[model samples]
Target: MNLNLRNAIIDNVSGNSQDQLEDTIVDAIQNGEEKMLPGLGVLFEVIWQHSSEQDKHEMLQLLEGGLKKQ
Candidate 1:
């Protein structure tokens, strides 16, 4: 993702409440629409970058579990 677009998403999301932001993220992932993928990727990238190693490991584990269920 371009830095400008990433910044734009951060700016746009900054106004949202935590629940709303989570809902938006969950919806995007659940829907799995083509257009939403890039935004989801950006979200994941941003999260992965800032997360602690333990948190990242937990997240990856959760992701693995979710993938296994599918």
Candidate 2:
């Protein structure tokens, strides 16, 4: 058996509008289901790969702040 989760997730969400993407993300977070984490990680990977250095830095800072709040 073989599974390529990242590609599968990407394919599922491909061609979705911005509002649809936001709904998917928000629903995944609100549901707090473990299965959705991989999809979220894949989405984040896409975002991170395309982000500018400044964007990356800001994302890291936001992540750091979120971690500190925990």
Candidate 3:
């Protein structure tokens, strides 16, 4: 994803409250389609960029666990 677009999504989520952000994410997931994948990827990228090393490691672990189920 382009850096600007990624920043924009981060800004949007950051501007909203946690509950709202969760709702947005849930909606995206529930509505999952090919089109939604890019958005999710962008969100993951933004989160990865902003997260601490430990947080990133934990996220990677969680993702690995989830992927293993697929």
Q: Which candidate is the best by TM-score?
A: 2
List, in order, the clash count of every candidate structure.
0, 0, 0
lDDT of 2 by residue, 6-67 (tens): 89999999999999999999999999999999999999999999999999999999999999
Least well predicted 10-residue stretch by lDDT in candidate 2: 1-10
Off by over 4 Å in 2: none
Ranking by TM-score: 2, 3, 1
> Model 1 off-target regions past 4 Å?
1-3
lDDT of 3 by residue, 1-70 (tens): 3478656666767778878877987888998776767667887777888899999999989989999999
Question: What is the C-alpha local distance difference test score of candidate 3?
Answer: 0.80
* Model 2 alpha-carbon miss at residue 4, Å: 0.9
TM-score of each: 0.71, 0.96, 0.73
- Better candidate number, 1 or 3, judged by TM-score: 3
**Model 1: per-residue Cα lDDT over 1-70, one tens digit each:** 3468777777777778989989989999799798887777777888899999999999999999999999
Which residue pairs show collisions in model 3? none
CA RMSD of all predictions: 2.9, 0.6, 3.3
Q: Weakest 10 consecutive residues, lDDT, candidate 1?
A: 1-10
